[model samples]
Every structure is written in structure tokens, then in C-alpha cells.
Target chain A: MSNTATDSSETTARHNEKMKRIKAARDKMMAGKTEEKGLIIVHTGTGKGKSSSGFGMIMRCIAWGMPCAVVQFIKGTWETGEKRLLQAHFAGECRFFVSGEGFTWETQDRDRDVAAARNGWEIAKQQILDPRIRFVLLDEINIALRYDYLDIDEVVDFLLTQKPPMTHVCLTGRNARPELIEAADLVTEMSLLKHPFRDGVKAQKGVEF
Target chain B: MSNTATDSSETTARHNEKMKRIKAARDKMMAGKTEEKGLIIVHTGTGKGKSSSGFGMIMRCIAWGMPCAVVQFIKGTWETGEKRLLQAHFAGECRFFVSGEGFTWETQDRDRDVAAARNGWEIAKQQILDPRIRFVLLDEINIALRYDYLDIDEVVDFLLTQKPPMTHVCLTGRNARPELIEAADLVTEMSLLKHPFRDGVKAQKGVEF
Candidate 1:
């Protein structure tokens, strides 16, 4: 037999042994996990896909024929492609509440921003309590919390106490509070590696919006 | 006048002034960016939403009536919720090529894995060059690259040289190569903050799969 063939066979055998060990470990690890409940998922940090991932979850929910609600806290200035598409496809099934005036810098007045956040939170809270809404997306609620427009304590308290047991809530934005993170069942922090905006590229119509 | 009324008026005036300044800055910034081209986006890291975010981009492309393709490289062990959902909605518009045998540990054969990766890459390259495919997702391709099942140099070269100018390509997985990162237009690392698996929660039906 050739030396190359012998070496290849040896490697294959070793790899097979390693895989056996891995499968055993993974099976043991997975066997311990049997619980299922509604998740408080937070997508935060300085990355591009916080809102995008939240929308993906909504799509998954929609595919399962679950009624979903989206409460936009700081993205009401311009119309989004998602809003237009979801409205066209899921008119009665999906309820969208765009309560924010605009971004904080765009709005300029902290008072108005506060009022908008409060209004958005009211809708979000109502959605959370509604058993009909299987998933509630508090879109960009982290920004409102970061700016202190909405009280973190109250938000955390509601998440802990008032939400229906079967409704999943997703909060998306940068700089998610530690308190919210503590309360979340799953938290993903999107780390910015490279962005096209830094390279003088404008956001395209369907890509960004 | 009452204190509340005076404060409200001052706040509105200040907000309007701030919005004007913001519009000027944003307009000026946007004016400088006039170039448009296809983007090579990478979603990597140890988080859970890497593939979910790529699917979000696919959703965006679908909204624009663009034809898209999904070539899953390492997630073919079981039926995924996304595959079922997207296939049902996008019927003839989207093409899904699930070329993976399974995870490495499950397959336990290096030679088979390499062959699967090669087959998947051929389809990926062909789809990437197709004008009809506006968006192509190489889902979990990074895992194939990391394991050396697929040649990173060949993948990087194809991405750099052969991609259609207006066709966006999204690569999703953990541990994306530095070369791929350098070639990508946008790269976002999904940082793992907290996962339900660690808290004795198995992957749920509609949420994880």
C-alpha cells in the first residue's frame, strides 16, 4: 500500500474516534435541556442587524401563523420596506404601531422624545399583555431606555411580571441596559466589524430600509 | 401662561431647530455617497442570529421582488423551519440547495464532508454568477472553510473576482476567515451574550429550528 493511503486511513480512523466522543458529549448536554417557555430576547450592541434579526424572528412567527405586533419606538420618521411588505402580506394579522417622532438627534427635544417613548411603551405593554399577539417586537426600545425616555425599572418590571406566559418579546437597539440583559432569556450583542457607511457607501433602498 | 405650556412651546421650537440641523448634516453626508455596487456581507461570531440575520436580508430582497438562492453548507441534518417557510412563500422565485450531509461530528467522515463542500461550492459559484439571482446566501459556509473542507483561497478569489456587480452575497457562520473579512463590504460579528442552551433550554420548534 502507498504511504499516502496509509496516512489517509489513519487520519480517518482518528477522526471517527473524535466524532464518537463529540456526539456522546453533545447528546449528554442536550438531554439535560427539556424546558420550553416564552423568551425575552434582546438584540443589542453596535452592529447592523439588531432590527433585522428581530424582523427575521417576526417572519418566523408569521410563517407559523402566529399573530405578531411591532411597536416602533424610534424609527417612525421614514417609511420602512418591512412595514410596507408586512402590511401588504399580513394586514390584519400584524399590527404595527409607529409612535416615535424620529431619532433623538432628529427630534432634538428630549421632552417630545420622552412623550413618544411613553406612548410607544403603552402600546408595547398592551401588546405584551395581549394573548392574541404571540410575538411583540419592541423595536428600538433599547434606545429609548438608554436615553432614559422610558424608565428601565418599569420596563424590566413589566417584562418580569405582566407579560403573558406564551408571548415572546424582542427588544432591538444598541447599548441594551444591563438590567434588561439580566432579565432576558436570550441576548445577542452584535459587534460591528466593518460597515459600508465608513467607506462612503450610502444605504440602498431595500437593503437599509 | 402655565409652566407646562411654556416648557412645551420651548421644547417644540428647540426640536424643530435641531431637526433642521440634522437634515442639513444628513443631506450633506448622503450627497457625498453616490456610488452603488453589490455588497459581500459576512455574519460571523459565536452568537445565535448569524443565519437569522442573513435570512432577514433574504426577506428584504424578497420584498423587492428579487430572485434569491440559499445554499446551506452544514445544516442539512434535519428539516429547518426557515427552509419550509421560504420555500412555501417563494415557490419558483427562490432556489434552496441543501448540500450538507450533516454536522462534522454527525458525519464522522472527512472525505465525505470535503466532497459535499465541493459540490455545494460549485452550485454557489454558479448561482453567484447568475444574473437572475439577485441575492445568494452561503449559509454555514464558514464552517466548511474552518474545517478546510472548502478551500478558503478559492472562495475568496471567486468572491472578489466573479460576483455579479449588483448581486448581493451573504455568508453566514462562525469563525469567518480574515481573508473573507478583508474582502467583504460589510462584516458583523454576532457576539454571544447569553444563550438558552446554557440555561437548560433545548432548541424549540419555531424558535431555534
Candidate 2:
């Protein structure tokens, strides 16, 4: 028992020493990261949580009393949990625009899709430029871009140049345009290692929405 | 002029037909997904937004009027935007716990780290088993598990067997144990494609925190 205790003690000391070194390195690294600027953030890939993340950031923004806007390019009239929250709870605080009534299901009009995309883009442009809004989430605008409904160069140019210095814009969807990715300050690809839908499990409430 | 109109009409018709076929396939596929169960969700990768995604999910849970709990296992006592939000806005609605005071810099006590992990685990157990708490987030618990501060099998067994049927648990961090991933119903790997930190931009407030 005494030997076992001694052995554990020695292990603890080694672990402590190792941890100290890591902490030192991390602190030094953190010290160098001193500059801050508005970031063009992108969340993309064939996985869940792309839009969920953008929605989450809005909560962070709300927590900080920062004015944020969400422009839903695809899930237009779909009763999303976030939409309900924004409507019922944060109506005055956050600006929300549901531009697309939804794709293909409601109408197979490509022109209509294009028009909705443009409408969403218009709102996004205003929010991105508006210094009042610190953060703007362009939810699923990438899908519209993917289908060639919006001009990639125009959107990228506007986001890169016209966006206010401290205002951040997050675009979430799959197949984010290469131009946007190249222009973004931060890009996260949420890839699906596994999804319940693949195993025939239906989407659940408050989780999928 | 007549030829141009005819060509445009034909293009629109083709697009409509294509969209219809795609929608039909999706509806058929969705029809097979009929079962629902509380999910074991894992957000793990070498990227940002793992915790951000978890934070976002909490907002969704709150929006749905569900009482959720967030047990922060790593960022103990650190001021996070979510923690502030929970305290300031959703105090009663969400239970927030920060377990780790942080690693190494504060204290070089391995035993203390282990104890903190256990302490956090104790809270996690109660929250996971509590039916009132519909959702629980084990933020950065994977790091504790990675350091062997908590037994993986023990943690996994408790999460799998002891968790309430309808309650959901989310584990977030880098390098999640394969056992947890294997058991997870939904796993999204948030990979870093680009980060401003690489360009020497500091972690900004509201966005990072």
C-alpha cells in the first residue's frame, strides 16, 4: 500500500510538471494574438450544426446586448425554434428576415428562388453594412449561391469591402462558395461522422429545428 | 423575341421538373425516418465552434421552453458569453456549472484536476439523470477524459445506462474518446479550414467567448 501511494505521488508530480510546460507555451502563444477585427465566418459541409452554430452565436450576441440580424435564405416560413425564440423573446433586439418560403416544395420557380435569394441578399447587405448590427447570420445563403441564384463575386465584394469594421457576418450552409471561403477570416467545416438520419431515426424537435 | 421566350419557358419547365423529382425523392426518404430517441451528440475536432455549437444548442433548448443544464468541465470560472447569458437572462431557465478552474496556470495539482473532474462528473450524473433537465452539455469533458482524469468506461457506462430516456447530453471538446463517438447518435467534426488566429488576430469578444 505504501509503495502504491508513493508511485501515485511520483506520477502526480510528473503530470504537474508536464502541465506547467503546456500552460507556459499556451500563455506565450496567447500573448502574441493581440489584434482584433471583424471576422467573416463561414460554417459549411454536409453535417448538422452549421446553421445551429450561427443561431447559437446570436444568443451570445443577445447576451452581450449586441444587435444582431438573421436572414434565413431557405427555411423561409418553416417554424424553426430559433425563429420562434427571436419572435417571442428577442423581437426588438434581433432583426430576422425569412426570405425563401422554402425551396422546390412550395414553388418550382427558379425565378422565384432567384428573387427570394436577391431579397435575402438585399437584407444581408443592409445588415452587413449597418454599423448598428454587430453580427449578422446569413443562414443557408450558400445553397442559393450553390444553385447560381446569387452573384458570388458581388456578395463577396460587398462582404469584404462594404461591411462595417466591427460588424461580423456568419454564413452557414453546405457548398459555401470558394470565393467566400477565400475571403472569410474564419471557416469551420462541420463534417458528419455519423448522423441519426442515416440510421433511419427521424429528426427530433428542439434538436433538428 | 418569340424564340427567346420559348427557350426561357423550356428552361423553366426543365428546372421545375428536376426540382419536383428531387423533392419526391427527399419526401420518400424522409418517410422512412419515423423513430425518435434522445441523442448522444458529440462535437469534437481541431477547430473552433465545438463549444460554440453546444452553446447554440442551449439557446434552442431555451427557445423551446425546456429546462437545460450546461456543465462546463474545462473552462472553470472563466467568463464565457454563454455563462453570462445564462446568469443574466436565463438564470432559472438554464442551470450553468463551471467545473474546472482551468489547467496548470492556476494550480499544478493533478489530484485537484482529478477531483474537479469527479466533481463535475457528479454534477453531470445528477443532471443527466434528471428528467426535468431535458438537455445537458458536458463542455470540454473530453479533455478531462483525454488526460485520464476521468475513466472513459465509467463515464461512458454512466452516460449510456444512467441517462434518462428522454433527456439529452452533449459532450464537446477536442479528441473525444472513440468509445463516446461510437455511442453518439449524432457526431459533427468541426474541422478548421481557416482561422484568423493563424493570421495573428486575437480571440475577439462575443464571437470567441
Candidate 3:
């Protein structure tokens, strides 16, 4: 019994020492670390989680009292939970723009969808160039371009010409254009390795949404 | 010339009729649908993007073409562009939990944060209770149990209760209770947020990440 106790005590002491070392290292790393300006991140791919990753970053910034905006293309008519929450909690800190009419073919009005897409793009452009809006996300801009709902050259030019000293831009969607990829400082491509749809299972609540 | 034009017109009319009818029906319903699924969603606010409005839903389900597992328990984090896209793309196919992550001091024990806040509830348990993961997102779970590093009752009970119907599970972090949140469908969270340390400026980065 005595030997066992002694051995346990020794282990405890060693563990405590190791923990102290870890804390010291963390403190040291934090000491010199200063916040840099910001980055423009483009998340695109055929896989999943691109937008989720970007939003996770946005949440962190808001926690620290940041300002931001979001402009989406290709969807309208749905009251999303995110929009509700943003309006309720981040009231003055964020702005949102949805396509407001679903897809062009679904609406049977290519002209209307194009008009909404353009409007959404215009909002994104304003935010991208705004000095006050530190972060601007052009969600699904890639899809809009792919569908020819928005002009790619005009969008790319705007992104390239934005004021670089303060603003950070994010673009999320699949089939990102080569031009956009070339212009971005950081680009991530999500690839689909496996998915549940192959098994013929339907979307589930909480898991699929 | 007249004969040729007439023939072409007749052919085009026949081809477009079927497409037009389908498009019209789709447009009418899609234009007035609610984006989010009505279920027990938990967007528990403690992490950075607990309520970035179901980003996980968009990433795992819509973008990746899978089922969904989503619980959002907070109402904020909507500045970035990703949220808009998710709403537009994944409309009417999400479950949400929208409650703030409460407060910091509410859960501060390392162990408690792990077990109860992270893995404590049966919500996460039921979520990952399958081997056919379509998309599982535990939004803002870290802040719920208060940063307790471990909470046996919360974590163990939930894990024990979990029986994944599919395989994909995601856990977002921000003060992630290591023990509890780790036992997730999928786990990821924001590590950095631009803050005032950069010359007393506000948060920046494509609208905060």
C-alpha cells in the first residue's frame, strides 16, 4: 500500500510539472501574437462544409464585436433560421440579401431571376467596397456565375479592385471559376469523398439541414 | 423560307411545352416555402458561430448532397456571405436550435465543460445514433455546458444514448467542453477572430470569417 501511494504521488508531481510547462508555452506564444489585418478567404468545392467553415469564422469575429455583411445569390422566398437569428441578435452588425424568387427555371422567368441575382450582386459589391464592413461574403456567387445569372468578368473585376487595406471578402459555392481562383489569396476546395445519398436515404432533420 | 420557318416554330413549340409546364408548377411552390426545417434545432450560443444560421446544414446537406443532422441553439453570427448561400441553396431542408450560448461563468469547470456542456445532453446522443451519416451538425454545443472540460453525467449519458442512424456528425467549437463536445457527430469550430488588438480596430475578415 505504501509503495503504491508513493508511486501515485510521483506520477501526480510529474503531471503537475508537465501542465506548468504547457501553460508557460501557451503564455509565451500568446505574448508576441498580435492581430494582423484580415484575409480574403474563398471556400469552394463539390464536397461539403465550405460555407460552414466560413460561418464558423464569422461567429468568432462577432463574439469579439466585429462588423460584417452577407449577400447571397440563387435563392429567395424561404425564411431561413440564420436570417432570423442574425436579425434578432446581430441587428446592427450584419446585413443580408437573398435572391428573393427561387431559381429561374423554377420561376419560369429567366428575366426575374437574373434581375434578383443582379440586385444581390449589387449588394455584395457595396459591402465588398465598404470600409466599415470588415467582412463581406458573396455566398453561392460561383453558382450564379456558372448559371450565367451574374457576369463573371464584372464580379471578378470588382473583387480585384476592392480596397485591400481593411476589407476582407469571402466567396462560397461550387464550381468556382478559374479567374476567381487565380485572383484569391486563399482558396479551399472541398471534395466529396462519400455521401449518404448513394444509399438512397432521405434527408433527416437536424442532420441534413 | 416560310415553310422552313414554320417547321422550326412547330418543333420548338412542341419541345418547350413540357418544360414550361413543369417549370411553372415548381416556381409557384418554391416561391413561398420556408427555408428551415421545423424541428428541435439547437444553435446554442457559446462558440463563435453557434447561430451562423445552420451553416452545417448547408455544408453537409445542400452543398454535399446528403441528408441532414442539425441542431442550432443560438441566434446570431450572420455577417458572412456563407449564411446567405446556405439559406438560398438549402431552403426548407434544415432543423434549427437557436438559443444563446448563455454566459461564460455559467460553465467554467474544465471537467464540466467536457461532459455536460459538450456531451451532456441526449440531443447529441440521438443525433449521432447511426452509422449512415448524411450530415450531422451540433451547432454551438461547446458553450451550452459552460466550458466544463468534462461532465460525466452529461457526456457519458449522451454518448451512451447515441445510436447513429448514419455516420456524419459535426461538432463546432468555441470553449468546447473537451469531453462532451468531442463525442460528436462532427466537430469543428473557429480558432481565430480578428479583434481590437490590431490597432484598436474592430473585427475584420470577409465579414468576420
Candidate 4:
């Protein structure tokens, strides 16, 4: 029994050494390869900075001379200053698309919301698949998907099928689909610990936007 | 001019309100979005947690049921127990690709080093663009990009074009590309305030993955 135990211990040591050598070799081969890629998703109960998080990424991509597509669902009628700045400064470099119709309950038109969502989804779908467009920000996509304006299964399927290496995609909104979380590479839940709105403070510009 | 000033002040106030409203809406939406979506970039000049920090995020992603891809660039031809554990346990759910080519000058093969680098890049690209991929950890990607083994423009372009509204990408490497630094929505530079490595202690497994 002692001999057998010693034999097993020796075998384990040898096995460990072999594994180390193999890893070293693999690391070498990996270094030989070139290319790096990925995406970002920011959704959580929040004090702030959900869409801003997505937009900040957009600006960063642009500074690197990369093209980006922004698709804002929900707040379609309201004019966001970001849309204006991106258009004027980034002209031809950055593209922004809105739902054209306001929001779900506000409009009280499910058909319009569905139609508007489809419009944004089409743009996002194309950008997600494109190898040339690196940073695709699906601004406020959760509400649309939540309201059943867009099919979750179809969206998830497309995300699963995307190709090319190094493409970065970002989805910012509340109520992200469960399947999306399951399928994501990294997930961050921004649970809102507290907010001023709860204190009856009205929304303010610049600071809030 | 007075009239214009009044209009400007009113517009700014309105802008603040718009920001607040949007933030509130996002918070409300987040209540139902339980799945976490976000990327964690672990970077520091001097610290034991560079890789550890990244691996922590990886562990979190796995717990959430999201698949992960890890590419280690600098630590070539080294035996790491963490790498083995991830490969053995996570196996199908995770991929641990190491560059075996050793350090840049240690091997004295620039051409081969470049080729190995390119290989890592290829793997990274596939992982990053895979929408189903929840997280892609570019371990030491900053080093690769800094060394010019990986093309900066190509990396940025890929980040921009990858599927949007999905995919979370994490870049963990020192001396991150200035452009990449600018492009990151959330950039955290890990400063090496103090480390065992500085005092001549060898790297330990589990502590430095």
C-alpha cells in the first residue's frame, strides 16, 4: 500500500509538470495570433448613467476613428441634445435614429410602438451584423422589447449568430430580457441604492442628461 | 441678445429636465431587468490583481450563467494553475488560450512573436464578435496593442462594428492605447502603487492568474 501511494504521488507530480509545459506551448501559439474584440451591456436599477454609459462608449469609439450607430427607442419625439451634437460634429461619422413616435403608454398605441420599434430594430440589426461598424449602441431598447414590440427570441438568435472578431455592441435600457442575460458574456446589475427623484426633486438638465 | 440669453437659459433648464426624466425612466425600467449586462476591465501598472481582478469578473460572469473567453498575451510559456482549472472545469463553457511563445525578446524571434501575436488576435476577434458570448477577456491586450503586435486601428474598428445591444468586452493590459483609453466609456487605469513583484517576489498561482 505504501508503494502504491508513492507511485500515485510520483505520477501526480509528473502529470503537473506535463500540464505546465503544454500550457506554455499553448500560450506561445496564442501569442502568434492577432485580433481582439468584444461588446458592452449597461442595464440595472440606477441612480443614473445608463444611456450616458452607452453614449460615453460611442464617443470613445469615435475618438479612435471608429464608426458607430445609435438607435434610441422610446423617447422618440423628445429631442436629445446628444443626437444634435453627434450629427453636427460627427457628420457622416455617427448616425442616430429615433422611433419618431413618443413612448408606449404616452401614445397609448401598441401598433405605433410596435411599428416604431421595428424601425429601430431594423437599424440595430444591420449594424450588429456589420463588421465595419464597431460600436453599436441600442439606446433604450429594453422598453420596446419589454412591451413586446420586438421579439426577444429573434433578437437573441441574431446576437448569437453575429460573426467577425472584435465587434463591440452595447444595449442600454431597463428590464433587459432574461435570455439576454443568460447569453451575455458579462452582466452588471446596477441596483439603485437610492435616488433624488424619490425625494421629490425634479429632473434637472446637464447634470441629469 | 437679451432675448437670446433668456432663450438659452430656458433651453438649458429644459435640457436639465429632459435629462432627469430620462434618468427616472431608466431607473423605473431597471426594476424588471434582472439579468446583468456589463464589462469589467482590470488594469493596473503595479498590483498582484491585474489578472486576478479580471478573473474575479470572469467568476462573476460564470455564476450568472454567461460564457466567457480569455486570451492571455504577456505570460507566455508559463504554467498557471488557474488557467488549467478554468480549462478543465469550465471546459466547454470557457476557453483559456495562452500564447506559448514566451516574452517578446526572451525567445529572440521577432517574426515568430509577431505571428503568435496575430494568432491571439484571431481568437480574440472570434470571441468578441460572438453575440452569444457574454464576456470576452482580452487579458494583457493593452500590452499586445502597446507592443504593436495587435493593430490599434483594427482593434478600434472591430470594437465599433461588433453587434450592438449585446456583448460585453473587457480589456486588461498595461499602457492601454491612448485612443482606446479615450474610447472607453469607463476607463480605469490601475496604477501600481505597490506590489510584491517590485520587491523581487516571484508570481504565485491563484494570486496572479
TM-score of chain B of each: 0.92, 0.93, 0.46, 0.75
Cα deviation at B4, candidate 4, in Å, is 56
- Model 1 misses residue B23 by how many Å? 5.0
Find the 10 residues in a row with the least total lDDT in model 1 chain A: A200-209
Please count the clashing residue pairs in each candidate, in the order shown: 0, 2, 81, 56
**Highest-scoring model, DockQ:** 2
Model 3: per-residue Cα lDDT at residue B38:
21
User: In CAPRI terms, where does candidate 1 land?
Assistant: medium
- The deviation in Å at residue B19 for candidate 3 is 8.2
Docking class of 2: medium
Residue A107 Cα positional deviation in candidate 4, in Å, after optimal superposition:
1.1
Docking class of 4: incorrect
lDDT for each residue of candidate 1 in B1-209, tens digit (9 for 90 to 100): 13498886786687668767887898788888877778999999999788878877777777778888999999977677678778887766678998898888888887898889999999999999999998899999999999888989999999999998998899999999999999999999998888888889878654666
User: Largest lDDT belongs to which candidate?
Assistant: 2
> TM-score (0 to 1) for chain A, all models?
0.92, 0.95, 0.76, 0.78
Candidate 3 lDDT over residue span A1-209, tens digit each: 13497785675465446646666765565565555655556666665555655555554445445677877675466454445555665667777777637544555555565678888987887777777777777777787787666887887787777646566777877888888777765566655434444433343543433
lDDT (tens digit, per residue) of candidate 2 on B1-209: 13498797898788888898888888999999998778899999997788888877888888888899999887886777788878888889899887897753556788898899899999999888887998999999999999888999999898788888778789999999999998888999999999998788898766888
For candidate 2, give the lDDT: 0.87
Residues A1-209 of candidate 2: C-alpha lDDT, one tens digit per residue: 13498898998999889888888888888899998788999999998889888887888888788999999999997887789888887887799998997865556788898889999998888888887889999999999999878989898999888888888899999999999999999999999999989889897766887
Q: Which run of 10 residues does model 4 chain B get worst, by summed lDDT?
A: B200-209
**How is the predicted docking of candidate 3 categorized under the CAPRI scheme?**
incorrect
- Residue pairs clashing, model 1: none
In angstroms, the error of model 1 at A152 is 1.4
